[model samples]
Target: MADLGAGTGLFTRLLLSAGAARVDAIEPNPEMRAELEAALAAQVAAGAVRVHAGTSEATGRPDASADLVTAAQAAHWFAPEPTVRELRRVLRPGGRVLLVWNDWRGVDAPLNRAYGEVVAGFTEADVPPLATRVPEAELPGLLPGGFEKRLFDHAVPFTRERLRALAGSVSYLPSPGDPAYAAMTAALDRAFGEPAGGEAPLVYRTHAYLGRLDG
Candidate 1:
């Protein structure tokens, strides 16, 4: 499997656990690559994975060599045409391209609303979800030949730690030291309470777009 833009190897780790034979974690950001390396050290030592520093548009794998390719929450950063071509070049005939995204559902909920207000105060824009912006209408250009998409609805248990980590995962948020950062924290506190509603988690819609290359 190809794990594109594998930040800190989160999705890569999941793929490994799910028994993928091998995963080539492709990441372009240096700091993120370092984080990925640190996170996947044991996996690499166990011979479960390899890491490649590159972008989705230019994965260094041999042509038509991969059996399956997956980009988790990172394809949006790539320009569709080049990325699709690169993916096609590396995927074996009849291989599948799976695009995965974890979009938070019910963003209009009370807690979510407070979360958005904080982010908006800082960035002048709410932290727009990546999946919602995908060019589903122009998908033909993104997938050579044709493809199918599937929506996988799911939820992840969220706590203060997870929420904080989620906020940190985003690229635009002000750091904990920044002044606007306090506002975000305050917003989070107001929205989720000091400890967050017990174990009951927010649901997220995990959208999966599986596009196969023509044989």
Candidate 2:
């Protein structure tokens, strides 16, 4: 299995836990790969996993080397044409590519609304979310032979600090050293204001697409 754009190996860990015998976790960011390697040290030592610095457009993996390829919440940044071709070249004849997204766009709740408003306000207004700039569903259309999609309700337990951490993790949001970072944290802190039992739901819908590209 090949895990592309495997940020901090979150999905890669899931794949391993789900019994994917062997996995090549491909991440482009050195920092994230470092964290992934540290977290999966035992797995690496046992040959259960290997971490590589690579991108979705150029994985540097041998042709048709994977039985399964997955990208979670990372494809939005990929150049679609190269990404499609790369996935095709990386997978074996019967291999499948799975794209997963945990989206919060349309959740109808007060806390979620406040959180969204803050993020939108905090980011560069001129630079829109890639999902808004282009319909994300179009990736499925880009698949040579279409794909199957499934949507499930997904939620995360949230607290003020966790909310701040989650916001910081987003690629577009201000990082810790940015001028707006503290302000963004403050806004998130207010949005997450005093939940019963000190927590609330970070609601989302998990959208998954699975299909084989034409051999």
TM agreement with the true structure for every prediction? 0.80, 0.86
Model 2, span 94-190: residue lDDT tens: 8898888888777886668989999998777666565432255576544666678888877778888788888898767899989999999988887
Question: Who wins the TM-score comparison?
Answer: 2
After superposing candidate 1, which stretches have Cα over 4 Å from the reference?
A: 105-110, 117-122, 125-135, 161-165, 194-200, 213-215
lDDT of 2 at 66: 97
Predicted structure 2: clash tally: 0
Kindly give the number of clashing pairs for every candidate.
Answer: 0, 0
> What does each candidate score in C-alpha RMSD?
3.1, 2.6
Overall local distance difference test of candidate 1: 0.74
Q: List the residue pairs that clash in candidate 2.
A: none
Among residues 3 or more apart in sequence or in different chains, the pairs in candidate 1 whose N, CA or C atoms overlap within 3 Å are none
Best by lDDT: 2
